[model samples]
Target: MTFLTLLLQTPAAGGGFLQFLFPVAIGLVLYFFMIRPQQRKTAEAKSFRESLVKGTRVVTIGGLHGLLVEVGPETVLLEVERGQRLRFDRNAVARVAGNPAAEGATPTPNA
Candidate 1:
């Protein structure tokens, strides 16, 4: 059929550049909207883990909340209950227990 023949025909000369441009534009959109934000969030989490200090209240990725008794290079000792402590990896911390102001707050009140 004539319609089939027309559909099989190659695109116009000037349309070649447009074909490549569409995929490149899509790549840029994906990088900015998806990949870039994830990278930034990961960096922030890493920095927070590195800067952790003793006496800070924190929650782990497993939803366990505790007061940081000791912060080592790659591990942290958490006082989950009075006279009861557990050790976990630095990366296990999800975030500070409360707000920014609670960073240095007394652990007993929050824990």
Candidate 2:
């Protein structure tokens, strides 16, 4: 009928506008929920790498745990075992396990 056709025509432009907004809304949601968090974590990791110091205990991205013997501009010297050392990029360090400032941050359970 003519009335049905007229109603459908009017809704088409409005539906198109909604469709245009959808991808934009998805982009924003992805940015906030996924992209923003990753950026912040990367910033944190970079700062931690820059602040690394000798004599600190750290874990690497490859699961090697060691004492930081030297902190270079782009590399670190780690003592992984008795009389054995290894070299790695600064970014290879994942988290500091024995930072003096982070020590005692959590209370140990009394057994």
Best by lDDT: 1
Q: Over all chains combined, what TM-score does candidate 1 have?
A: 0.76
lDDT tens string, model 2, 1-111? 999988888744457778899999999999999999999998988888888999989999999888999999999999987858999999899997765565558856972
Question: In model 1, which regions exceed 4 Å deviation?
Answer: 1-14, 99-111
Per-model TM-score, in order, reads 0.76, 0.71
Expressed as tens digits, the lDDT of each residue in 1-111 for candidate 1 is 999999789576667789999999999999999999999999998888989999998999999888999999999999986668999999999988887475577778546
Measured over all alpha carbons after superposition, the RMSD of each candidate to the real structure, in angstroms, is 5.7, 4.6
Show the lowest summed lDDT stretch of 10 residues, model 2. 98-107
| Native-structure RMSD, model 2 | 4.6
- 10 residues in a row with least lDDT, candidate 1: 102-111
lDDT of 2: 0.88
